[model samples]
Target: MEVSMFGGLVLVMVLVVVVVPALLVGLVLWLVSRSTSDDGGAPARAARRHELLVSSVAVLAAVVCTVVLLAQPVAWPGWASAPGVLQAITPFSVALVLCVVRAVGEQTWPRPRGEVRSAPLARRTIWSLGGARLRIVLVTAAALAVALVVFGATADPTGRAFATNPVTLPDGSVVSGASGPYPGWPYGLPMLLGLALAVAATFVALGSITRRPPLHGVPARHDDAVRATSAARLLGAVQLCLGVGLGGALAVGGAAIQSRGQNLLLDELPTHGLVAVGGGVALLGIAVVVASGIAGLLAAWPRAARHAGAPAATGAPA
Candidate 1:
């Protein structure tokens, strides 16, 4: 009871002190990203700088991890077995994960100052009330249906009790029972689908922001840029979400498969066998997302940099 109590306290503390702050910060940045244009201000410049920093950090971490592994080989769960070596390399893994997350957040970086000013920065209209909500409902319902089907279908025929205590294998190369007794597919499919729904909702929300009819009292050039920005932002966000979902599926699903290996042959599992395919999907998503963001910025570039680009008049139809 005491151990459980202590664990609960630790979890609560972690959530309050770490997770909540991270989430809040992410939310702020996301809103800012959607609102701010790439006009070389401190925020825009910072956004540009962040991309380089993340990429450089990722590459540097990979190189360092490779060097460390070569210097002192360790088992797969090195953190548990050879803590000293893994401790050094863990930073790199963490940095890589952070870089991936940051890239996803940055996918919402806005277009040119001129285009964004003409549009409503934080306004909602019929599109959000009608189209976006409809999209969300349809997508979420479909995902839930699919999740239920997969969950029920993947149930173990023999009803094997899941291992409560995970242990390292004798070979020390793999660990099993890192997850619950449920089949990997049952758990992973739902998670992947949930992530997908969130992505789809975000795309729809961004689309609603671009609901500027042709008669919107803005210049044609600015209107076109606004539409382009909306498309670019939505595409970038979609790619980011897809990549993250695929990556999460592979990681969690692979771990679950390995956990079940005491009874099941994970090597023969299609999900485990097709890791290369999963990686390709993730990489493709990341590439497309990053490309869209960069392209959006370039496309929104105005001929004049110092110009305070806004709508011709206040209260214009955004």
Candidate 2:
């Protein structure tokens, strides 16, 4: 079955519009049910209230994205395709930005599971390779390198499509049937930029999450909770952004191929299967965002439960 670029765009529309709302609804309902089951007579606390507000915002964004997505494919005179992607990304992007900002003000390091006082992880934190910090950096760098290979270095040099150039048929006639695009010195630069930005964001977020207090004693349980939430939320944001950047590059690249093909009046475009690849990336990113959010919340719910019952922190006199 031959799928066109337009068809893939609509499929992405369904992903962002239909699937997002369904996921949000299911998540909200699940949280409500879990809370009710856990504490049948308890009143909602500040954390629960905050989560509901965030859910409401997410649902609102999903509805707006639905309208924009539905309008995009039809090119409803006033609705432009470019805005569809931007709109879909805005809510997620904003949420992530808030996460990072909040991280900025977080405690320099976590307290021991049982101790009350807090201090820095070390005299100078930069050289500390302990925990997930170095791992996050290495993984992010590896991911960027892979993206560069797949999207940039391998791009077709002729600037027509990725890894494609003109070919001579048996009839001795030349055709632009190359499977890739023409490349240039600056080719695929935007993809690299997008990847770099995502990597940078991931690094900063991971650094904040991995600042552990000296680890001896019962503090380990709380440390595990911190790491679980951090991994879920930070990794989710990273993957979401990475997926968007890669998917956007593929979509734009596919459009370029269609344009070149039409201009050349070719029967087939250079990048025949590009749309499917882009759609897949978009879906992966959407899945990561939803999954990570749920995981982060679940990881922290127990911590919140403990906090709800424990006495408030009070500093002892020197």
For this target, which candidate reaches the highest TM-score against the unseen true structure? 2
**RMSD list, candidates in order:** 14.4, 8.9
Task: Please estimate how well model 1 matches the true structure, expressed as its whole-model Cα lDDT.
Answer: 0.36
Q: Where is model 1 poorest over a 10-residue stretch in terms of lDDT?
A: 79-88
lDDT of 2 by residue, 1-318 (tens): 112343355456446534564465547545764564323122223223433344344434544554454444322234222223333333234334534543553343324355444533223232232234345434544654464466545455543254346667677888764433222223344344434554565556556645534333323223333344334444443443344433444444444444444544454434455455544544554454454344323322322223434432222111
User: Model 1, range 79-191, lDDT digits (tens) per residue?
Assistant: 22221223222322332343344344344434333223455444444344234333533443344345334433544542211232234565665543323233233333434
The residue pairs that clash in candidate 1, if any, are: 177-259
Clashes of each: 1, 15
Task: Count clashing residue pairs in model 1.
Answer: 1
What local distance difference test score does each model get? 0.36, 0.41
C-alpha displacement of 134 in model 1, angstroms? 16
Candidate with top lDDT is 2
Off by over 4 Å in 2: 1-26, 29-101, 104-116, 119-141, 156-160, 178-187, 209-227, 247-318
C-alpha RMSD between model 2 and the true structure: 8.9
**Model 1 alpha-carbon drift over 4 Å, by segment:** 1-152, 155-200, 213-218, 262-318
